[model samples]
Target chain A: MMTYKSEDIKKMNSIELLKNLYQLNNATMAELVAQTSFSQSSVRSILKSLENKGILTLQNVDQSSGGSCPGRYTFSKEHFQILSVFVDEGTVDLKLKDILDNTIFHKHIVCSLNEELENIIITITEKYVVNCISIASSGVIQDECFYTDHGEYMTKHEIALNLKKRTTIPIIIENDVNSMMMSIKAKQSCNNLAYIYMSETGIGSAYYVEGNIIKGHQSFSGELGLLPYQNQTINEVIASKSAKEVLEDMFVLILVAVAVTIDPEKIIIAMKKDNNLSLTKIKEGVSKSLSKRYLINLEKSTNPLEDGLDGLHYLGILKLFDLYTDYNREKRNG
Target chain B: MMTYKSEDIKKMNSIELLKNLYQLNNATMAELVAQTSFSQSSVRSILKSLENKGILTLQNVDQSSGGSCPGRYTFSKEHFQILSVFVDEGTVDLKLKDILDNTIFHKHIVCSLNEELENIIITITEKYVVNCISIASSGVIQDECFYTDHGEYMTKHEIALNLKKRTTIPIIIENDVNSMMMSIKAKQSCNNLAYIYMSETGIGSAYYVEGNIIKGHQSFSGELGLLPYQNQTINEVIASKSAKEVLEDMFVLILVAVAVTIDPEKIIIAMKKDNNLSLTKIKEGVSKSLSKRYLINLEKSTNPLEDGLDGLHYLGILKLFDLYTDYNREKRNG
Candidate 1:
């Protein structure tokens, strides 16, 4: 754990300045001074330090008169690379993206239950200079371990430990639904949102509150399938549904429950591309059951698999930056 | 909205220091300097400012040898009073508590459907010199206004606005379940908790994540009555059940749903004193339904009404302190 001290305040201020520069993309000394309350000398000193650390680059754009202008500071685009993977029941999709959002590699692999996960990860790492690895799967993850609700993979932590031994980079294993939620949160401006994921196997949910995903105490949040309804669980009803109206009714009940409890700004239903369901019908059915004041917007996800992969990539990049920040803090303290 | 500039940083540091002093109750200058990373001179400067503002008092503690010793700084208690009220369907319980947690007055009044809420509030305010008022009711609260789920009250906001005209103190209206949750959070150390408030009217829930309450987008995050279960909602099942076993079964299903979704560390069932159900049976029933990994501790609230009132008082005091901080900042800027 890190404790904030008076000395750390200056370091924190520098980090804030660097974050602003990252967000700004390119800024001159005068623009930076105008953007922050820090003195001009403080801004210059911090920028020079970042430049020395190879985190930022300074470039001078000359005017038509040929006179020297203040140099512009820009964050390094290719400072790190992240390997993100989304694992389904029988298939795995992998993508390696740079800090600048460039996709360098993409691959999909179909694997059997007995396949060696460690060897597959090692082979992928040998092909790229990855700084962090993030994998999304359908399960409960805690303390770098995975526990499946219905699966045969018993040595999940052993696989994670084996991967850790193969590389010095950090490994983040997250639930697939949580990954999709993060992806949606990254793209939307709403502070409170809920993502409902429906698949042939079961239905789950992920809540986004003020930029943070609510994973709950044991990482078992969003298990909507466990909800008992109509003398049976939601999963049983959905699985046994014979008519479209029955399915729509079940959805309406779920939506009404979500609206009345969470009252999110938007409810996103994430399904496979092949599962065609009209958002309009579902929204209309839910609206009739709820009061006007409690009506919420409902939409369908464009691409859930891609969103899950993107969420993994985003989380991996965040971990890489956190590592960088911690390394710098350690260097400063030393 | 507030932005953090260099000047605000100084003010934040002062607030942090003051909070530490408030938590510590009393400490010498050397002790304060040792506790924080700030310099001795900085500590002295902040303490002197607080002393001059009458927020803290300095006292000398002599050594055993009868010689002069260092002075101690203590936060002044009883600086303000909070008027807390819990409004039920037909009755209102009120209490006036000081900043030091002392209850100065308590009253219970029965109200009819057509009674003017502003007059009741005015009658209470006339009995005390209150700095703030906090009301906990069974409704959806937003923007300091109440909205009942099922009631005859048409203009809840108008009533609140009218009360504002009669009293100059700050007023806060909150959901009763949220208040109970807040009170429990204040007294416990659990980071993740869920409180299930069960009454004859309906069943509601409150989720506590980290140090903040999850109020959702519209402050309707815990209306469990809307959840569909077993050909009816949880509220419907509980309200219609006449046997203890039936109620236990319903509780088991609800607990399983909560466990699979939120996975809270502890689930506190807040029921009226007369509604006696065995905790062991409910725990056993839920554990049998869920896997061993999802087992959670279940407890009963000792006093729901007191907790609600205390929560109101606590929130009112917090708002008061926030107001003090903002006022000081404005003064400094002026």
Candidate 2:
């Protein structure tokens, strides 16, 4: 359904093959075939085309493994710089990464998002020859065109589209939780998945069901903090810390909700890199009533921030590939 | 991805085509074409084949007002009898339905489940020549091979498989919540959906993500009542009526859980076809915290039981079509 309409029977397109190869890094043709389920002939032809275009490189693996082995193809193209941006409350975090995923530069600047976005795009793209700009922001992304200031009811900030006008560099923006979830999703496949980020000051959530992300009707699905608990909303309780004693209790409720309703195969609860009583308490409380089947699916992550940043990086790199592939397609058509 | 593998580029199969035609009873070729997204040629070929097999019949339309319209084809095979059984506590509800979904016989029999299952199957089949047996039961159904009484940890009841041995008819079994969900799903397509059935005595939930039911690991999902909630489990609280005043409050939490995580396009709250204090309270509480983006997705249904029965009917009828399809395929191969 990602590339083809669900009803239309379709072949694995070039982007899918590229995505698999990029994730696999240095992998033989056979490995790419297995990862993407493309026929050997199809994989070979695509690999050959990209290799001829200098977008891919092949290196022979040592026959030290039992017998003769096929050559491994690496998807690295270090020339392409991916500019990844994460919009914080009063700051924007920026990172420039190469196709090999090396962080060339990382910066955090305190500024209003609406005012600084245009400047950020110009300043970074000029400095780094950025191939793609991917933003991970916290709000409802309207068809990835604009980020609504507060949920779906607030003033619409046309961040992605406005930035696209500033430069030819492809601009891809998504909800923060969605980006974090996508980062994890890119690492491995989990049919049904829920990613929750909880910390001292903030909470975020993302969901994946079957194959695609569970983006709500208005793309405002992962607004978990807005959910009601007692007289105060979940975000209020978190910010006030008035319900600190029952914070674990509230987390239990949230986990149970996701577990029972979404029925994900795995739910990753990412807390801050540093944590205290919350994780243990949440797990213990959940274990009390949630059956072992669901309890086992609950996992704790200490790298929530890293996951979010990595998500932006992956998004930028892949989007860069999409641009390049489109260009290649145009070239072939011509 | 429903019938075809995600990786496989495949055509609209026979079963899918038949399902549309069956659901769109007395529908024209154009209607089936739209529903299944099959080509005119493909639909015509499949219809012709089934017509040759005497499973389908085409009829002429009046077209009184407009230009001559296409003939409508009906899928009313009166010979097929479907035995739909819903296992209730201290009793079993059985209904014999024809292919056109007409209930020919209905009964409520008091019996111990494990002890009387065999007797019930033998008696029903002997008297009626039932073509298909569909069961809507509570608890975990593992691979549709066995129904575990408690959860995944409980003793396995090889109901479907065992009943299949005693009778040649295809046996279809699903969790009651799933059956209700499938029933709604058959009526219309909602990409992300949650179905909640709330009654004075019991609570059940089912989820649809992307295109399929979220049947968690161990197929022990939709165990909503087991979720942990403030000292007592949800089921315990429901059973004792100890928290009757706060029942709607609890339900709001459940709804929020489903809304935020699954991010369904619609969440159907099916009450027991009666008015009470809960529904209003739930809507109010949810409205208070959830913004218009999500609150609009909440829907009320007074026909939960009907949906479940309809689900079983649809499942049984479609499965019968599958059997006939396989036989036809075999004949062609031979």
Candidate 3:
């Protein structure tokens, strides 16, 4: 199924170079050549074309290495802006970021799903020329919609339909756990990885195998909270009682479930910082059940909110590239 | 990490064509051109070169559809012969397969692992020009060595080393569950798949995500038997008593674990043909816990042995290509 030839590389050379360049802080023609394994002329022409189109900017760094060439190139960060909306049970946080991931605006509100989301987008779009919207929610998200949990008053809600009607920009709606996993993977670089996130919105888990997220045959592939425990679901056990009380057994069981199934290298546990869940205690409990023969890094997320946003921002960049970057044709800027 | 370009296509073209051609029965030049996006001339020249090298045979059939063209080209199945060895606790089965996957010879012996394997290879090599050896065992297999279950007299065995001393051929040692999953996947074609195989060798599982197998952070990724149950490992529970006694609750818990983790579309259950484990009972048990909101196909393997051999054969074919097929360089015959 993975059949391919070199002509594919020749076709996708410019896109690959641009994408690789975007990943770096700044790159030289020599660096680009090494990074892409393309000829120096190919990198030179592509960068020149991108600079002419205002997609990239040439920074005149005083480096004697490039005696006869232009200075380093920086991907024009402000070329495309992203509005990342993170919605949970009782809170909504929005950050307007440039293509370079520089936050231009930030706001938070106490609401579930209402006109407030549309208002936030309007507020952000009014200030900055946003190119895409990335919506990361606590519950399962399908297409441009979000599906909340059972027993919730508002079960389903449209994510960015109002904004869609007003703007021709692209939008992405994704499950919080999956997006969280993506960003954490960017940091951890764990090919086979699992993610567990817990907060006021409750707990959710995601599985990443190789380079792809195992969305399963279903949308809710990582609904760990729905797993059965002692006469109650995992969510019920945590919801009714202090999570600390049943944390050991719950954590160990989750370890077993994930470790036996996907066997990820790192299982990132993202929790609300104020939840008072001790990492040492959790590790001690897990170590008692699992031996050191197999090294599964069970660690806490440094900052759930920031990491989730990172993932959302990366998704936004990908969405923007999908919408605008067509190397086969003329460059279309929104 | 997945940044790639199309020139990769130009380099890997003929190899891709040969690899793809091996998967099919026979294809006309038109079909080959369509299969590969390459122009008709590119396909024609490649096929002609392959036909000249005796790697492919041009067949002539009485059909007006081809017009002036040769009927079809079948990959020369006799290009390479592979020795597939299946090792279990009680018995070991060996089959000699051609590149086209035809069984050239077959033999079964009542043993786990010993010098008998090397002797059999020596026997096969004296008659047939064997090019590769694929060893599929019940327990964990790493590198060219096979690690058997605990309490077994022979825990570690060097697989086909004595024969390797005689012939410079490719040899692969893989876990049986993984091989079983590969072949079942070829039939089922489930993108996200989990395989549970129950035979005299005991219960084991393998996970497949996207197009890659989740071999875990460790080599023994699919050691499902080691999972904790009621006061005993899942393997110990099944080993100590009749699997039928603990089948329902055991199956239910497994379903809950796998469903909550990597919610594969299909969970293939391969059991011993003689064991009277009813699918109805297993399905009823699983459905009691899991709701109808999501669908997961839990079916039995029609023939575990045949499916596993198919996977091994496919692996053998890939190994042959890796060792012999070089589109950029002159053809090497061993």
Candidate 4:
């Protein structure tokens, strides 16, 4: 089966053979020739080139089938590590994963908003030789810098520049909600998706159209909290509401807006893990406002934080693959 | 010098040569070779093929460059005509446009919602041999059928099927608001655009993001009239308002919603030609609600009917091009 990682790999024909090998983890020359459309000699040449670049290792696995069993090739596991970080208001979640998306290290650190984020990142980098780093945070990110809703210690670009002084690796900065939506898109096959993050502080939204994120003209497409509902904005109503009836009414109103405006195939609501919000009243209210044909399938996120981290990991893997392809191209051109 | 039509033409190499010939009307072979990237032999071959297909005529022109004079080519004047219809509640506006989008014939007829649309279409089609027919109507269109706010005599599919039985030409059915947005997109270069059509009866919105329309998962996007505001839906408020102050406030509220959510580069408001609505109060209200950073440049449409017709004409041209390309490909393949 083709994964999201393979989807990016298939864009460049030159990398497709190596990408298939990497996805298979361990495959014989005969197996690769059968799997790919490339001729046997082209497959052999690509494998030899990858081996010369130290990207894969070839070894004989068996000799029972013929006079000489085809050798098995495996991608270099030690060279595909990625460091991912998910930053929130007062906490940071760190993860390290391999090319196959296997988590090698996971840790959670509780710190104040004013804590030295650079020091924490530097400490993690000192412990691992990651090919790429990705950070997902809450706010509007532009020009490699993040502008949070409240405030932050340093801009993402500043931190990236600081990290660059110590290590020479690519770093990517993405919005948290955008990251969560990306994770959902990577896992699902739906064309249009609206991921609404409703929490105690505020409500935000991110939309996915045909597997691409809709950031609007200024990257503010899904600022649902600013939507006015019944005399107050959506966030204000959510924050002030203490009665269950009011909350249900507010959810219904917001859902109606999303339904009529976006008409997404699926609506994924991301709330706090401890929050006990029922979908019954929300669905009932939406049904009253919209026809059943326009209704969307509603779902609650099981682990939004994990989803964000997985999304960051996937982004890091893409960056790493891009770097790998660029290096291969430069070597060939030179 | 490349307009949107030229942009579409450049996608297919074969069409680019023919389109350049059409755009230039009559251009010498030397001028064509100098202006286009094709080799002289290639240009001659394309011109020969087009002439053989009865699309263009070649004529000798006097030398202006003080060298050997080359023959000029012009597209056949009578070969490309399109029938366009804009359907409203109690009337239908019909137009016939040539290849250059010049109106050849236009008429506005008083027709009830329950009128037999087929007879009217047949009446017009009998007078002209059109290459394509395009219908733009006020409704949500899906699978060639339109679902209107109120009952109509025939769904768009029924009308299209009826027309197809009479003529073998291609037919396209598009939402009116979507057509308006398409027209705006063709004339402008903005990456993100949101067009809102506000009349005494209802309001509809259409969004253009990165040169594509956002039709949502169920093709129900941009249903702005359903948005609830001030104890009622937007349409109800628009209907109940007799005072100018209330109308201004309502427009401001809707503008603010669009401003913060979509962050569009431009917002076009389409009102009735005689409506005495001013933008000063609407702008002030939006500025008060949203930060200046999120304020969008607002403008009003000068001639909405013309814009809608222009949009339909452009769509019809695209359909005609598709049919032309398909025919050529089938001939070659066979």
Candidate 5:
């Protein structure tokens, strides 16, 4: 076990301390001491400090057999707080979550990606209780992780550095498509997958293998939009905001491509509630295209398994933020 | 330290033993004792008995301090072996490798897939000595995991359960594209990647995320060939034999679509060695297509990253077998 001396425990931030407790599986001090990579004495001090703040509660367990005195400990989920913001072309969703991927609070508001975009972001962000923010937009985010007006394309690192000045909490910016991919990848059903998030505005993808998302060179891989469809237009297939275009080209790009390679056990498509008609048309078209392949004798054939996510859901956002934190920690440490 | 008593160990087939050893990182008795979930003494006994046979070796690391006792251990790579067979439409390559991924021996021969396919597979396989055997091909292989084949449209998996009667080595069968994807995904350089492999017959893809290959519903995914290409077909653009069609359609299907969606940090194009002229033409065409999009910028602008693999390397077959075994074990235990 790593020996966390008393002084270190006293100086720890709420985020760090919460992670420590979470690592203990929400167990009490005695249980934590046995399970943790941290030393026993340090766990006791941290537990006491958290309890003093009224952020935790202690419950007594039965006495240990043959022991002179029974053990006691404090526990808390108060440290589990984070703010997640997902920004799209004209909207941003803010959410607060606990470490266990439970939502505390959330709100959504419409906004423009105009010249005053930064100011609008700050104004909207002030409403959330959680300060730990992560943003996913429709453009390329640079290494420092800042967005540009250019859709899904980061201008430079200077913009990211500038954004850092406005926020105290570490802000992680990513592409919206990639975020959804990471979200599905973290879910039990989509454990090993190559995701295709075909939205009305554009197409996005996230590749997951070995329980990790593939962020290619400069964290810019899985740009499925750039992949060619018919007539030299990749977006025409999966990203057309026009329902007719989406219906016309969906099968040629998303479904056929997905069916042929990495035959993912499941494919989850995210879209708005009203787009069911377009989605149905797409499903039929794709099934027809796949069936045309004479050699493909599927043991069973069904509509490419499709699921929808209401982008406004707090549970989904909380899960997204949790995954982002997990992603960041893995990269930073591993 | 699974307290696998001698009886449990005795009950295990060679494949099971190899899988356990691989997961253990081929450790020695002492190291295994410290790491396993099993009892320390049980591990020590298992190591002692296995070492007694020629199955494994325990070597001592010389002490930096002269005259000190040496620390001894075993490396799994030194003890395990794999026989890999790569079958093509008209040829086959048979080889044996140690767990360290070294080829102990190899043989290449021409054979027609249309004639006596099973007999040819058995004949080539008989020449190797190994604990596990994996085969990959270009077509869709059914339930049998004995052999793998690649093709112009979809890949297949077929396993020869009867092979157990011929050799103690476990047999793994998979599609060539999936196998290659697994191989690429396993490489530290290409972890979490969307890779494009263009061979003589067609274009295909394999995706890696979080160190896992994305195997879709039919156990076939990464079918880039089905994604349409303008001017010519996708098959023409990706397959080695369709030089004219590939050259003409390269810009329309590959570069533009790749840039918009699956924005891979590095787009690796696998081609044939002698097809340099066609490759250059395709590059020029793709560059012109990609230059139109500002976001289509790649670190290697004019020259895309490309490598050539042996037509019958069957790299993904070996990897998919390992992944499947791990998945199977996790499934059984869970």
Candidate 6:
């Protein structure tokens, strides 16, 4: 959280200019001058400096889209790159990508729980990842270094000694769920949709609205596990060791009681194929218990169970666990 | 929608600069220069221009926080004005406020619906609201003016025509529920929490993360009423007339079903005082139904008799329906 000084901002603007040229592919000096509040001379001067740095290429004047006259401009993609990283307990994935979300190169490595976890992880990153380019990650990486639990393994004194040895690039660390949210934003059809990733051991949710993820203060806003509950909360029921046991108990007691009571828009039961809790069994159990409430004959009489979950049946909810691997990889590496 | 041209973007930046200044509470030229990408000269230039237009003042300046030297700058309050209109089928509430959301003045009017409803509304607005002020409303007010149905008499087309006539200020139209979401944001203790305001008429949800309300695409995302219900849809049961007529239709058929399913953190039930449906009756109804599932003793249990709804018993559901009125004005206007 470096507060911007005047000189720092000027340098940041220069970097932004390089990024914009890379993002736009090509732009005339006049276009930059018009698009930005910067004067024509300032834009020209910046373009010249960028060209000298081998980060841009000047093109001949061309006809404007509809303007009175066309203008010459500079464009380059040489210096355009993003280093994203995804970090989790024992695994870290890092990638370099373009602004278009396309990965240029990527690598995944495992950091075994050793006595020197931090030093080992940092060493691997410095050697295999950061030597030539930038890095991005799934875990919270800040200030061009890994904010890992490395210090826990090594003493606080040793941790500082290890980090000083490597030349770190600009790194953007993101949470796994946030990475998935960004991937969902890449989808063409998804608008105002929330992505809830029910992993093997945890229930995580990412809310997307207007093509951006709803990241709250401290970036821990979507921790649905902490949401209040009676008897037991959603996280306790969904992500705990006694999840199945609790479900079995609630099946007769709370599940049926509440199923007939609080009817949500869609009771999305997000799970994988390996789970013992099948949508079919859940639906069957619900039907038998709440027979008086939901008329089961609706499906047999009118429309058959269509493509999606419908007709009071615990319709097989959106299976997103399959996308978890890609989501994780993209988040850490990109 | 008018695609932002380069010229329009420049104007938007100017407006954003002005808004940011208002948010910062009249910062110095040095503060403005540091907070934004503008150079000292550019900041001075804009400050002078705005002061000339009577929108800013060259107030005394002090040393930058933790900096070596002190500097002078201008403060602007003239442009810190907002003309907000809250429109529903029953009434239109127009208010003028400063950037700090302090209301300068307000007017509430009732109008009859007709084919020319938009014309009537626009005429009233043009007559009352100041020109070139930033305009916002509890309806889709985009591109100076756009028509949208207020779910009652006036068609959106009529509203659009009037908006076309008045294009002085930058207009931002949003859903009434969205406006309520903003109001809720202003009232919340935590920025990451979700708010649900359930009234006799409908249920309004406002999701906040990082202090910004989640506005779904086309601003129609939180149409929670449209979420598919079990056996039926939310709109078919919750907000429909047929269910309301059937005494316990909404509770036994709808509200109870939702309680057992989604299990929201807190569901505030805002209702009218001395209304036909009281919280006591709702709890009694739930207690009777849930007895089969859980051996709940309403007499001995603290759940049902609580001031607000707790666990499965929605006892204090009436607080959700807020009797919204100008409380401050009632004392003054009286």
Best by DockQ: 3
What is the DockQ ranking, best to worst?
3, 1, 2, 4, 5, 6
Model 2 chain B worst lDDT run, 10 consecutive residues: B1-10
lDDT of 2 at A148: 50
How large an RMSD does model 3 have?
4.1
> What is the fraction of true interface contacts found in candidate 1?
0.51
Question: Per-prediction fnat values?
Answer: 0.51, 0.46, 0.59, 0.45, 0.47, 0.06
What ranges in model 6 sit over 4 Å off?
Answer: A1-48, A54-117, A120-167, A180-195, A207-213, A224-334, B1-44, B57-84, B95-107, B112-129, B132-157, B166-172, B181-197, B206-213, B224-334
Please identify which of the two predictions, 2 or 4, would achieve the higher DockQ against the true structure: 2
The C-alpha stretches of model 4 lying farther than 4 A from their native spots are A1-80, A111-116, A149-157, A161-166, A320-334, B1-80, B112-116, B122-126, B149-157, B323-334
Better model by lDDT: candidate 4 vs candidate 6: 4
Ranking by TM-score: 3, 2, 1, 4, 5, 6
Per-residue error at B206 for model 1, in Å? Answer: 2.2
The residue-level lDDT of candidate 1 at A161 comes to 64
Total backbone collisions for each predicted model: 0, 0, 16, 0, 79, 35
Residue-by-residue lDDT tens digits, candidate 3, A288-324 = 5555455657778857877777788878876665544
Candidate 5 per-residue lDDT, tens place, A67-161, comes to 54444443344543555566655765666665555677666668644435556556645764444455566665656554554544545424335
DockQ computed for model 1 against the true two-chain complex using alpha carbons: 0.40
For residues B1-334, write the lDDT of model 4, one tens digit per residue: 1112222332354565655655566787777777676777767866786688676777767677567666778766566788888876678888998875567889888763233776777777787877788998887776666666442243444577667778777889888887877777656557788888876677888887765777877766787777776767778877775577776788887776665455678888886664667787788777666545555588898567767887788677666655655543554688
lDDT of candidate model 1 versus the reference: 0.72
Each prediction's DockQ against the real complex: 0.40, 0.36, 0.46, 0.30, 0.23, 0.08
Model 4 scores what on Cα lDDT? 0.71
Order of candidate numbers by lDDT, starting with the best: 1, 3, 4, 2, 5, 6
Q: A108-128, model 1: which lDDT tens digit per residue?
A: 888622336567777878977
**Segments in model 1 whose C-alpha atoms lie over 4 Å from true places:** A1-52, A57-75, A111-127, A149-154, A236-246, A326-331, B6-52, B58-74, B111-129, B150-154, B163-168, B235-243, B326-331
Each candidate structure's TM-score, on Cα atoms with residue i matched to residue i, is 0.82, 0.84, 0.87, 0.79, 0.59, 0.50
Q: Give the distance in Å from residue B230's predicted Cα in candidate 3 to where it truly belongs.
A: 2.0
